[model samples]
Target: MQRTKVKELLAGAEEGKEVLLKGWVRTKRGNKYVTFIAVNDGSTIHNLQVVAEADKFSEEALKDVTTGAAVAITGELVASQGKGQAFEVQATRIEVLGKADPETYPLQKKAHSLEFLREIAHLRFRTNTFGAVFRVRNTLAFAVHKFFNEKGFVYMHTPIVTASDAEGAGEMFRVTTLDPINPPRNEDGSVNYAEDFFGKATNLTVSGQLEGELAAMAFSDIYTFGPTFRAENSNTTRHLAEFWMIEPEMAFYDLQMNADLAEEFIKYIIRYALENNRDDIAFLGQRLEEEDKSKPQQDRQEMSLLEKLEFVVNNDFERVTYTEAIEILVNSNHYKKKKFQYEVSWGVDLQSEHERYLVEKHFKKPVIVTDYPKDIKAFYMRLNDDGKTVAAMDILAPGIGEIVGGSQREERLEILVERMKGVGIHEEDLWWYLDTRRFGGCPHAGFGLGFERMVQFVTGMGNIRDVIPFPRTPQNAEF
Candidate 1:
């Protein structure tokens, strides 16, 4: 009596056995004698075909079995005579659980543009492309936890609301419960945050690395995976207003150890996805190939999606210092010809173009650039002996620039206090963060990996908005 998922039925559920299956109809086609219905329950990329005899079910009884309609069918499993699939269901009775009017259902038996699919994101999951993308995303997320758990890392849940800016970028979403039109004000006409919900200023956390550090101090090794928000108004294919981050803090890790762990961690997750979700990933690779055909030959990716994943997993990432990377960029033909839009200098931050050049053109592999200029990096990164560069590192992939960023944290209280003062972060605002260094600080290092960026990398999705379920962007928050 219970309904079996289409996946199970297709995965060799005993043939000739009567079974009940339920799913949404992906497509329905037939002549006067019979109807072939493709049903998919999102268990896998492929759909299960159900054959209904014209004599058994009259046209009136099967009127509601249209595309996008939810249906339950009681049938006998048998070997499929179809060329592509292995097995199918021969329906004896079909019930329309939810009827989708054929005249109004938006999803028809045709290809739709990715831009148009974004408009109907709520229903996009039913499409093959989105279904494949989300399945691979699910695999990657689970693989992240699994990799950390196997390494004895505790999964710590950090607060969503915080008073300190971890990145110090000053692009955080303010969380307030005060009236916007007319509210309490100070003597200088400034908005009073003392009476606010937290009794002081607070906003959605930009990164959980600070709080994650507190837990790492005690737990020895900890990681935080959660949502972070930014109020930046930039609209780009790579930027997202709200995104997820995976930050892992270790009590006694140096820059080298941090880089080693990051390398292992990235490979582990990618290997897991390739092992567990090959079908879904293969589908995405094909989708990318189709999309890339429209692009010019020069803009097309050098390697396919599967090839890129395998390359990252099997190869070692070339490691270089920020100085060396800058030197390489400065001497390259790309830089000599004045092709780089942003200037390439030792003290300046590396742009996406520079990062991509280092990975895709120079190294032809993933690269880890380390020891960045102290002025361009965050205040928390430990200052090197030269006092001009910080012990920071960023992992740059062929397609995605700067997939991971981390550094050895400043453990000396005196130095940390001086760095905080230099950056204008008051000692009072981050007293707790300082407490880690004040009391029992040792050499500690950690790094943050943008979860959506990882998804974008693994899935080969061009737009950052396509990977996340509900993208929150400037002037657009539609479902």
Candidate 2:
């Protein structure tokens, strides 16, 4: 017989039919009369119970079968005798595919701390939380591609090794072939010997937006969903040394259009996850309820697993200018007590706290804050008529401060050259990019959405590490 998914079988199926199932045992319960085992195959959230009589399957087989052991069972599906379950399989024949010794297996039936789980990432997926997170992560990624592909956006693969600092943050992980102990030096004592990878010096690309923009000019609509690297050492819930970014650049588009695309894109991703992974969401809900059974209903709603996503996906996101958001922050009593470390002026880069307040307290929804100061934004952003702000926007959601960062590109050759010079970015560094503007550039806009942050927001997973399967953080790359 063909193998059947546990979740599919439990949903609705013939009770008396024979089926073959495969998965690792999640838990095992038994009395003297019979034994029951719950197994998950990473197909869905639901686990199938394997019911076998003591006289039917040997006690030695049952004794050898522990949690985390992989097994294949040919059984007859039957209406579940267990409480709150729909269907179960009564094993006719059992096969032990792989045995995970109880003494050696890291994951057990007992609850493990997230930090402890992080140490055993190789086996972490066996846990329900990580399984659901990774599954939704996969779905969200699919939704991103589906949204862009359906809209005629050409997917472009930008280079991982590049010569330009797209964000100008100086946080690149350098890619070189030079000896660190006895490095070659130029006449002025600077690093020399332009014989690095691909001849000259190179490093990992921070954002694909620059190359993505070049592609957009030719393709009219283009996107890049790839891994971006940053060497920043800041340790926080949001920061990661290496993470994936989804960037979409469009030709003949303005800043407003960019913001609108971001809002709609996020909504689509959330809707996709909710529609396809309802069982995982429900499992998380039940776990939360069990974790805090005594909590009041009002308190529960505040931290419900799916409330923020439902709100953002169902409702229209709020849009406001950077100036207006600053005004609200200055006047609001809630923000008055909390002090910001950075300058709170109109042109300064808004801190994470300010962005969070705008979404969580003021707008009470996702807010698109646009028209940021040019000095605080990237060189590619189009300058506004006010002679100060750039046509830049950030999609700030309630839990995750800034989910998407985007801007309308400065297409004018003269204006872009001047902007690049003003930011101290060498014009020669971006000669090819400038050539595109001089030849045939149209008004273009694009944004970068942090993939892990999006997953963190959707799943209400507090740490960025928990969202990614093997999180790459500062000085930490354990499996």
Candidate 3:
């Protein structure tokens, strides 16, 4: 017999039809005559309620059907006598595929703290909260590819290892095969990278934008979605040693065009979730509401989950220059009250508090702050005619500070070389990249969307680690 997914079975499957279902037990309740079991197949957050007769399936076999127990149930569909759900399955035979000891299972019938769940991440997917989050995550990822494909953008797979630093952040995980305790060295006593596997220094890629730009020159428009690594030692919730990034590069695009594409891309995905993953989103929203109940009124979010998602989809993001944003922040009540931990200055990088203030309080919407000082931005960012600011933009969301960061690339060879040199980036290392300008370069622009951050914003998840399965942070690599 073909097995039916819990989602399809719950969604108006013909009653009185025999069905085979397989799932892990979420919870089980029983009396003298009958036993009730709630099962989830990872198809949706809602579980399929199953009713079984105590005499039919022996108590010994039924005892194996507890929380976290995997089972295969052959049953008949019928209207549920219960309150919350519409349909329930009356099982004729119950087979325990796998048994989880009720005494040792980390997840129980009652609510478990998120921190505790993280410790048992290998089993976290079985929980309702994570199940809903990952389903919405799947839809959002597909929506990203769909949005780009519909816009005639080619999907480019950039290499995961490279010699150049795209963002010049200098935080990278080195890839080598040399002995760590004792390795080959040059006459100068420095480690000889020539003796290494790659024959020179190499590291995991931090961004795909640079390579995506090369593809864009020929393809006209290209996007790369792949894993990027940053070896920062910071253990904050916002930082991840390894994460996914989405970068789209286009020829003949300026700063405004890049921002336009980013805004459209964001809205299209959120709207996709609202349409396709409505059930999961609603479940997550309700979960957030339950979590928010313990917070003070002043600390609560201004909008509900659906309301916040709709607001971004419906409204145009407020666009401002870095200079203008600084002025607004300095004169704002937070800065005036000395509540901001980081100083709000014209050239300083905007901190979480500053960015959140602009989006949540000052603008009360998504804000795209552009034209940052060249000193604070990457060498690849296009230098504006003002000779001070680069054509860069950071999109700040109401909850997450900066979800996307991108800039228009420098096209002129001399200027590109100068910018690279000014930043102490040797031209010999980026000869191929400089060749783009040397041969035939046109005005180009691109932006990077942090995949985890977007997931965090869409799902209303506070910690970045919760949004992604198998999060990689400093000193932690547990499954």
User: What lDDT score belongs to each candidate, Candidate 1 first?
Assistant: 0.93, 0.87, 0.92
Per-residue accuracy of model 2 over 48-135 as CA lDDT, tens digit each: 8889898898788777678999999898998987796789998988888999898988888788988999999999998999898888
RMSD of every candidate to native, in Å, equals 1.0, 2.0, 0.9
- True-vs-predicted CA distance for residue 226, candidate 1, Å: 0.5
State the lDDT of candidate 3 residue by residue for 1-479, as single tens digits. Answer: 99999999998665789999999999998888899999999998899999998778767779889899999999999998889999999999899999999999888878888888889998999998999899989999999999999999999999999988998999999999999999899999999999999999999999988899889889999999999999999888788999999999999999999999999999999999999988888888898898899999887888889999999999999999999999999988788899999888878999998999999989999999999999999999999999999999999998889999999999999999999989899999999898888887999999999999999998888899999899899889998
Name the TM-score of candidate 3. Answer: 0.99
Top candidate on lDDT is 1
After superposing candidate 3, which stretches have Cα over 4 Å from the reference? none
Q: What TM-score would each prediction reach against the true structure?
A: 0.98, 0.96, 0.99
lDDT (C-alpha) at residue 209 in model 3:
84
How does candidate 2 fare on TM-score?
A: 0.96
- lDDT pick, better of 1 and 2: 1
